[model samples]
Target: MAGSQGEGWRPARPAGWRRRMARLPLLMYRAGLGPLFGNRLLVLHHTGRVSGLDRTVVLEVVALDREVPAWTLASGFGPTADWYRNLKESPRTTIQVGSHRVPVTAHFLSAEEGGRIMARYAPRHPRVARRLCAFMGFEVDGSEDSFRRAGERIPFVRLVRSPAPGPAAG
Candidate 1:
């Protein structure tokens, strides 16, 4: 599951925690368990916020926001999630699907966009979404304030496939 990394995007861990987790199987479980259990997990490679080292996180590919061409990570522990913060700091990132690794740039959605995405998610996974919303302190109201209170704490980003690097000249 290890692979080459490049610039952009932020790692979703908090310093010491990331290092400690690396030595345990929990990191693997958090990064791979869902994918291993019949889910499409997109592996994201991001740089550490402090160390500037690379860190990989596995997140489920829930839905593609057609209007923005961005993938929605809604209600996945709300908007305050770590990965969201990483993307907020640096949108450029790498997404690894199976053996295919592609470079992409991320855009953190505004309150309006995030609200719409959250609405779509609620219908699909009401129970989980509610749990996430509650934990993140968000109401079902589709307003910027609600999103700010709930999502600002979590991390969310919309990614676009980045152009491939040109062939190197000899």
Candidate 2:
């Protein structure tokens, strides 16, 4: 399940310095520097499935729908990523984008929907899309069809802002 793309497609877990570097963005978010990252990145706050403790992870925003106030994210490390798994176990969570925090509910997108998203994304961020696909061990030909196929192979989740809580009854 880890290597759906191919053997060695999934990246090994980072450790030591690499792990520290990966978590740097989280620190920035905590330090109120989230605005510096704009909307390109977001900090996800979720509860660990087994530990039942709060956890945080920074993920890239694959798509943003301001109208719905939703953000789409891809599990670059595949669905086995701890963050991705945690979300599956606890779909209710919160995300911080540019110093703005919003409660959200995770919604897993279907493969066909993911394909459409990838097709739309590639044209907008060709370089990032190509690099991301390569990093995920996908050989894309820089074609919409190729990107769509690659997107179908990966897991995508949309974090939609939860409705504001209504006033409590007396």
Candidate 3:
């Protein structure tokens, strides 16, 4: 397994799959995964700081220690990536995994902490890692190296898990 501590990576997809994925349009590329993977894609809802309205986007989440925390990217693929920039401005967020929706806040990790998380969570796809590395501009050693450098361009949000609300004790 390519990982450490809370994060890790799975094996890479075959070349045939890569070609098929590359052929997909951006919107289709993002949506196709929903049906194919179902309940696996996480939907992130955030209020646009300027618009003051909610914007929703889908992201692939890396689940760390089950009950501990989850990690997601803001802009590792590109500094101009819109979804990531939005989250950076407004940390307040709602996350949907499967049918469950939970309210949480995003906290951007420092470069060092992000490197630590990346050491564990880097994915195996070289294409993906390469794209991330391009944005981060760091020397890549392996998936972990790419993951750590990916933080350079992308903001890392540590989901601030909140306690579930309950009935007030009378």
Question: Which should have the higher lDDT, number 1 or number 2?
Answer: 2
Ranking by TM-score: 2, 3, 1
lDDT of 2 at 157: 100
Candidate 3, residue 140: how far the Cα is off, in Å: 2.3
Prediction 1 TM-score vs. true: 0.59
Q: For residues 1-170, write the lDDT of model 2, one tens digit per residue.
A: 12255554586778999999999998998888999999899988888788877888899999999999899999988888888998898888888899777888899999999989999999999999988788788879998999999899889999998875111100
Clashes of each: 8, 0, 3
Worst 10 residues of 2 by lDDT: 161-170
Error of 2 at 169 (Å): 23
RMSD of 3: 9.8
Looking at model 3, the pairs that clash are 4-120, 7-120, 8-120
Candidate 1, residues 1-170, lDDT tens digits: the string is 00132223222443596657544433554555533523345667776565666676666555664454455454254344556666667667776655456677876667666655655555676675556665444454544345444444344566667775111100
Model 3 lDDT per residue over 1-170, tens place: 12332232222332796745634432442454445534335667776667766666666564333465464554444434555667678666676655456666677777777666666655644565555554344456665666666554345666665565211100
Whose lDDT is higher: candidate 2's or candidate 3's?
2
- Candidate 1 vs 2: which has more TM-score: 2
